[model samples]
Target: MTLTHFTFCSAFILGLMGLTFHRTHLLSALLCLEGTMLSLYLASSLWSSSFVLSTTSITPMLILTFSACEAGTGLSLMVATARTYGNDKLHNLNLLQC
Candidate 1:
């Protein structure tokens, strides 16, 4: 397959898998969110690589940085929640009546 076709196929698969996996625990959902972000970054990079210069590089770097921070914060929060509540299921969050 060509570059464009490969990009499209991979983006589609990653997006689909991300959506599908987002309904699980906090870590899985966070990972899925990251996967979706990666898909968007890859598609944008591949599509614009033919015309633009490195103007797009800054955005991807920022996105990567933000995603890393987000994942770290999420993991920390998950650890705290699990330590307090004994589990990390999304539904378990609703058990917090306070």
Candidate 2:
């Protein structure tokens, strides 16, 4: 409805598409995930601002903290995968074979 809403929605959709299209690379997927999280953070912050009755909602902070943790974990996984497989390709992360 509003410009902010449209912006956030489009950003989220673009991030989702990027994640899908870039699934072959671990780094790109992680970046897309981060972008999605950023859009979510912006949306949540905007929503929280409307609730003037309360001082402020902790949703934005919580999302930020979770995103940071997710980024750290994803980076570590990518680094480990690259070291183990010589490249960070998602297809190479197979666990079925012994």
lDDT per residue as tens, model 2, 1-98: 99999999999999999999889999999999999999999999999998874645888999999999999999999999999989999987778867
Local distance difference test, candidate 2: 0.93
Q: On a 0 to 100 scale, what is the lDDT of residue 31 in model 2?
A: 97
Residue 55 Cα positional deviation in candidate 1, in Å, after optimal superposition = 3.0
Best by lDDT: 2
- CA deviation > 4 Å runs, candidate 2: 53-56
The local distance difference test score of each candidate is 0.75, 0.93
Off by over 4 Å in 1: 1-22
Q: What TM-score, over all chains together, does every model reach?
A: 0.69, 0.92
The local lDDT score (0 to 100) that residue 44 gets in candidate 2 is 91
Candidate 1 per-residue lDDT, tens place, 12-59, comes to 687678667666688787777777677766766665666577776577
Candidate 2 has its poorest 10 consecutive residues by lDDT at: 50-59
Q: Candidate 1, after superposition: displacement of residue 96 in Å?
A: 7.2
